[model samples]
Target: MKLVSLNIGKPAELSYKKKTVLSGIKKRPVQTSLYLSNIGFIGDGQADLIHHGGEDKAVCVYALEHYAYWEETFNRPLPPAAFGENVTAAGVLETDVHVGDVFQLGESIVQISQPRQPCFKLAALHHEPKLALLVEETGYTGFYFRVLTEGKVKITSELKRTEIHPAKITISKANTIMNNKNADREDVHMLSQLEELAESWKKPLRIRLQ
Candidate 1:
């Protein structure tokens, strides 16, 4: 896949539901090269560290392929970084890639860890009450990458897959399963077994199993 754009942002107050809260879901596109680390891009940050900005989810990625559908849905010009992605990608979708898929980005190496768990912050940022649930339901929720090799990654960098995981659990499938109320115990076990999957994801599934 190709990197269409790189985005970054710090925490800022987001107002919604008659309340204001600090959120880091409104990212802006950047044109310069960025230093990628185990935690994230040098300039990137998240307000709620408990649910964001960790080594297992250093880079949030959204596909450019899904933009047309969403733009049509929203009936407006949804631009790059619209989903608060650190990397805007082209030529790949949630169903086409799998957990533990390793890719090289410019001088850095990264690996897919988990599908993005769309939060209320995203819905609030877009002024859509059900947007987060909609994203989860449609399996267009995007995904995250864990940096393996820290280095400078240019905005123009192209991603090349270096390795594929044995489990082959596509992000799309994971999203669908995640939203299912009747999620199978065997399916949950299979998903929990993936070493490349992030603990934030596995923890819930593990609890369900026990």
Candidate 2:
């Protein structure tokens, strides 16, 4: 797949529900190459570390294809990195990506960790209180990556698949189980056992399966 854009942003304050809040969800595309470390992109910032910006959820990746659907649904021209993804990719969707899939991105290596669980920050960033819910319902939520080998990454870099996990559970499947309370118990159990699945995601499933 192609790495369409590399985006980064610093923490900024925004008005949400008549209250000022600090967030780093509004990312802007960067023209130059950037370093990808264990923490995340060199210039990227995440205001809330509790739900984001950990070693397990380092690089957020969103599909460029989903932008069209969102734009049409909202009737607004969304900009690149609208979802606050560090990498905006094309030619790859959730259905095509699985947890544990390894790829060589630029000079670094990364592995798919988990599907992005949308939070209210998305709503605040988009100025639509229901946008976060809409993203979850649409199942277009992007995924995250954990850097396996730190190196430089640029917008011009290509995503070359190096390995695919034996479990082969697609990101879409994982999202369904995570968001759907009535999802099959067997599937939840299976996903929980996946070693590559992020603990943040597995914790809930484990609780549900209990």
Model 2, range 27-139, lDDT digits (tens) per residue? 99998989999989998998888888999989999999999999998899998899989999996699999999999999999999999989888898888899889988888
Pairs with backbone N, CA or C atoms under 3 Å apart (clashes), candidate 1: none
- Per-structure clash totals for the candidates: 0, 0
TM-score of each: 0.97, 0.98
By TM-score, how accurate is candidate 1? Answer: 0.97
User: Against the unseen true structure, what C-alpha lDDT does each candidate score?
Assistant: 0.90, 0.91
Expressed as tens digits, the lDDT of each residue in 1-210 for candidate 1 is: 788999999999999899999988889998899999999999989999999989998999999998998888899888679898999989669989999999999899999999999899989988989999888877898999999999999877879998988888999878867777588878888998889999989988888888
Q: Could you say which candidate leads in lDDT?
A: 2
Query: What is candidate 2's TM-score against the reference?
Result: 0.98
Question: Which window of 10 residues has the lowest lDDT sum in candidate 2?
Answer: 14-23
Choose the strongest candidate by TM-score: 2
Query: Can you give the lDDT of residue 195 in candidate 2?
Result: 96
